[model samples]
Target chain A: MIGRLNHVAIAVLDMEEALKVYRDTLGGIVSDKVAQPDHGVSTVFVELPNTKIELLEPLGENSPINKFLERNTQGGIHHICYEVDDIIAARDQLVANGARILGDGEPKIGAHGKPVLFLHPKDFLGTLTELEQA
Target chain B: MIGRLNHVAIAVLDMEEALKVYRDTLGGIVSDKVAQPDHGVSTVFVELPNTKIELLEPLGENSPINKFLERNTQGGIHHICYEVDDIIAARDQLVANGARILGDGEPKIGAHGKPVLFLHPKDFLGTLTELEQA
Candidate 1:
């Protein structure tokens, strides 16, 4: 089952501009930018007291975030992440209940260095959802 | 400053269909439906372990959600709500920092009976953000 809300991900055209809002304006502590080459995105974490905001920028032409950016030129919320106590059990239950897991249905090491899986938007009221191991 | 992530709001075309995704598929405990004529939307909350998910359906033809649904027939994530310890202070700081506050720059009672105010999407990387008094 889902645990704490992990982090909300947002696609951004430019990370620096996005940081101006979350970091300078909102006073959130911004983490060092990390390049997630495997995922084809550059990520920055804006830490807050209870959770974090993840800013993602497409790193390559084939990046999934590129397609999302094409659809949303101004950038927008990409997905929400929730922590799961047991990801395998959660994935099995979700799959059994007819939820489509993205990318070979296997958990990948995410930005947090924890196993994560993405759920298809069609299966979750049009919202791309990410499940991360707690 | 933001306290905790209060909820993630999703705009749905049909409440019943959306419920099947969040409640039945994901095993979320859903709350009763409530209509907010003033906001022109019908809302239901699915309580999760860390936070809540709000499903919003357009109540009237001129509802703001109707406009969002017109572009995205399949529905999608709308906005994110963050809890703030002092909403007035948060609003003042944000306004002074050039963040545009939606409406008349005032907090209104939200679904949870907490004071809430929305921020412009343009200022926050196209993510419509709501700040709720914690």
Candidate 2:
């Protein structure tokens, strides 16, 4: 079931500039940044008062973030992450309710040491959804 | 400057079913429901720890959320709301940076005593962004 919102993902063209803007101009604080080579994207997290804004930039051509950035005219929110108590059950329930999963049926270690699985954006409106199980 | 996230909108087909599931099974509390006849849609907000899940159901033929639900196979995250200090300045800066605004250039009173404006999804990489000034 849905607990607290983990974070909101935003796809940006320049990670550094975006980070500076979000952090310095907007008064957001950088919580962390990770280079997800497997996904071919680099991400920076800026923590706000209530939520964190995730900045994702594509690392290569085949990267999904690259495609998203290529299609994006301005930096926009890409996905919303929900912290769930049970990832498998959530996935099953979502599938039963006609949602599609994006990863190998199992939860994998995500950017911040939590298990995460991405829900396919094609199946879920044009928005990507992620489930993080702590 | 930025304030709290107002709500996380989600597009759905059957408002009743989604409301039941989110309220009963997920332990989400339905804060309020409104039929925005002007916007040609009905929305219900389920409050959680930090944010609310907004369920949007299209009401008529030309509803924007209708097109969204049409494209969406499964209900997904629609837009992330960020409360801003000033709407005009934010709109100007975003436009200067090549972001697109969806509505006519004025802030309107939104669902919960807040002035809201919609930014074009096309400019934001298919991710609908909203700015709410309280």
- Candidate 2 regions off by >4 Å? A16-27, A30-33, A66-76, A86-101, A120-127, B20-27, B70-75, B85-101, B120-126
iRMSD (Å) of candidate 1? 1.5
DockQ of each: 0.69, 0.37
Per-residue lDDT of A60 in model 2: 74
lDDT of 1 by residue, A26-73 (tens): 777889988998989999987766788899998987888988898898
- Enumerate residue pairs that collide in model 2: none
Instruction: Looking at model 1 chain A, report the run of 10 residues with the lowest lDDT sum.
Output: A45-54
Candidate 2 displacement at residue A119 in angstroms: 3.7
What lDDT tens digits, residue by residue, belong to model 2 across residues B1-134? 65777788888877877766677545567866788877677889877788877888888888777666765656667787878888888877776766668868677777666778887765544467688985
Query: What is candidate 2's lDDT per residue for A1-134, written digit by digit as tens?
Result: 78888888888877776765566545566866788887677888777667777788877778777665665556667788888898888888877876678867678887767889997765554557788994
Find the candidate with the highest DockQ and give its number.
1
Fnat of all models, as shown: 0.70, 0.44
TM-score for predicted model 2 compared with the true structure: 0.77
In angstroms, how far off is A90's CA in candidate 2?
A: 4.6
